[model samples]
Target: MREPSMPVRENAAEQLEERQSDRAYSKPVVVLDLLWDLAFVAAATAVLLSSRDEDPSMPLRLWIVGYALQCLLHMVCVCVEYRRRHNQVQGEVMEDGSGSGSGSGRSSSSSS
Candidate 1:
C-alpha cells in the first residue's frame, strides 16, 4: 500500500490546527458557563430541600455558601488547566513550525 500524499497530509494538518484553535474558550465565557451550571445545581438542590421536613435553615444556607465557594474553586482550577494545556499545545505547534521552517522547507518524509 502507498503512503498518503503530502497535499493530503497538509490538508489534514490544517484541519487539525483549525480544530485546535476553535477549541479555545474565552475566560469570561467559561466563567459564565460555570455560573449557569451552578445555577442549575443550586436550583435542583433548592427543590430537593423544599420537599424535605427539616426545619433548620441556617445550616443549609451555610452549606450552600460553602458549595458555591467550592464551585468557584473548581471553576478556577478548570480554567487554569485549560489555559495551561492550550498554551502548551500552541507552543509546541510554534516550535514545530519554526523547527521545520529553519531546515530545508521540505518535510523529512519521503512523500515530498
Candidate 2:
C-alpha cells in the first residue's frame, strides 16, 4: 500500500522533472546582452569625457552631474544584467536533464 505522502512525492518529482527540462537561457543571448551593456558603458564614458572641457557654470555642473548619474546608472545596469544572465545560465544548466550534478541536487536535498 502506498503511503499518503507517496502522491505528494510523485507530484514533487514530476514538478522537478519539468523544471529540469526547461531551457532558460542560451549562450548567444548572454553574449548579445553583454555586448549591449558594453555599448552603454562606452556611451556613458563618451558623454563624461565630452563634458570635461565645459565652463564651470551652473549648466556645466548640471551636465557633469547628469553624466555622472548616467555612468552610475549604466554600471548598475551592467551589474544587474550580468547577475541576471548568470542566474539564467545556472537555471538552464539545472533544467537540461544532463544530470551534470552541478550541486543543486545536494542543496535541494539538504533543504528538504
Candidate 3:
C-alpha cells in the first residue's frame, strides 16, 4: 500500500539550499572568518606541540602568551562586531516602528 506523501519532507532539500543562498554576510567576510578560524587552529596546534617538547620553559611560555593574546584580540573583535550589528538591528527596528524592546515581550506572550 502507498502511504501519504509529505510536502515538508520533499521540500527539505530545497529549503536548505535556499537558506544557504541567503547568507547574511558577504563572501569576503565569510572568507576572512574562515581564515581567522584556521589561524586559531594553527596557533592552538603550535601550543600543543610546544607542550610535548622536553624543554617546556621558553617556547611553551611564549606560545601560551601568544595564544592568550590571540584570544583577547578575538574577543575584542567579536564584541565590536556584536555591538555594531546590535545597533544596526536596533536602528532597523526603530525605523520599522515595531518598538520591540527585547525578548522579554515575546517570552511573556509565549508563556500565556
Q: What is the TM-score of each candidate against the true structure?
A: 0.44, 0.38, 0.39
lDDT of 1 by residue, 1-112 (tens): 2456877888678667655544645556666777876785687577557756766756665666567667767777777876875675566567678555522222232124
> How are the candidates ranked when ordered by lDDT, highest leading?
1, 2, 3
Give me the overall lDDT of model 2. 0.61
> In candidate 2, how many Å is residue 88 off?
0.5
Q: Residues 22-50, candidate 3, lDDT per residue (tens digit)?
A: 35344456557657766776777776776
* Pairs of residues at least 3 apart in sequence or in different chains that clash in candidate 1: none
Best by TM-score: 1
Instruction: State model 1's lDDT.
Output: 0.62
User: Which runs of model 3 end up more than 4 angstroms from their true locations?
Assistant: 1-58, 99-112
CA lDDT, every prediction? 0.62, 0.61, 0.57
**Residue 96 in candidate 2, Cα distance off native in Å:** 1.8
Tens digits of per-residue lDDT for model 2, 45-87: 7766887787654665565457656756765675676677567
lDDT of 3 at 2: 30
Of 1 and 2, the candidate ahead on TM-score is: 1
In model 2, where do residues sit more than 4 Å from their true spots? Answer: 1-58, 97-112
TM-score comparison, 2 vs 3, better candidate: 3
